[model samples]
Target: MSLGNTLSKYFNNRAETSEKHWDKDLQTHYYKTTKDKGLAKLEEIISGSSEYKINSVSTDHGEISFHVVKGKKAFVIGTVIMVRPYQTAIDFTVTTESALPFDFGYSSKLIKKLYERINKDLPLLDKQN
Candidate 1:
């Protein structure tokens, strides 16, 4: 591996669990569902993923927050906000518990995977609506 890659891995392995890199590593997604339904679907998608484990959930103030553990090294904080009657916004921040200052792009990849799953699952929800 390149020097940068090796260094990233080393740092990531040593990174602190309590530190969150949200300032530079955050993703947002928009969905066409009500706030309540969007929160429910978000919970379902995260819970259904074998790679993620739900840590906590809160629904209040017109938004939902989810704390999830992704795999063994990463923690993900997801928020669902009601933007309009039929529009909702989902935001995710992923942080790695390692010594490294970087996660080798794991955070973005995790967000993408989550987005894909939610997108794919929406059709099923639509069928039931």
Candidate 2:
């Protein structure tokens, strides 16, 4: 199965509602979060795959980068952004040519908690919306 499909299945198995199915926005967020939370894993995945090249730099909370592979042909998987604001959360992203997979089944409050853990401050809009 494709990477996207595999992740969709994984999230679906973990979801409790139809509304929680993976979507574009969540996919974007997934890409952003994985890169932020798991760089070494990302690098490991890439390195273990076909020939690849990675370019990265440090950011506020962590690091971000783009991985490219040139083999039978040219292919750009996507970018990664990883963040570890504190001991609380590990945010990351994993973008690809296709949409990444993600779910939004947690309660708004739970999601707020997650945001707060990573961002260090909860936005008022999270409660308003």
Using TM-score as the measure, the top candidate is 1
Of candidate 1, the 10-residue stretch with the lowest lDDT total is: 13-22
Model 1, 4-119: lDDT tens digits are 64466444522211112332223355667887787788888777766667777777744333344545467766677766666676666667666667666665666666667778
Candidate 2 has an lDDT of 0.34
Give the per-residue Cα lDDT of candidate 1 at 99: 69
The best candidate by lDDT is 1
Q: In candidate 2, residue 67 scores what lDDT?
A: 42
* Model 1 alpha-carbon drift over 4 Å, by segment: 1-27, 61-72, 123-129
C-alpha RMSD (angstroms) for model 2: 12.6
lDDT per residue as tens, model 2, 24-123: 2232222223333444444554455455555654544344344434422222222333323321222333332323333322222222332344343221
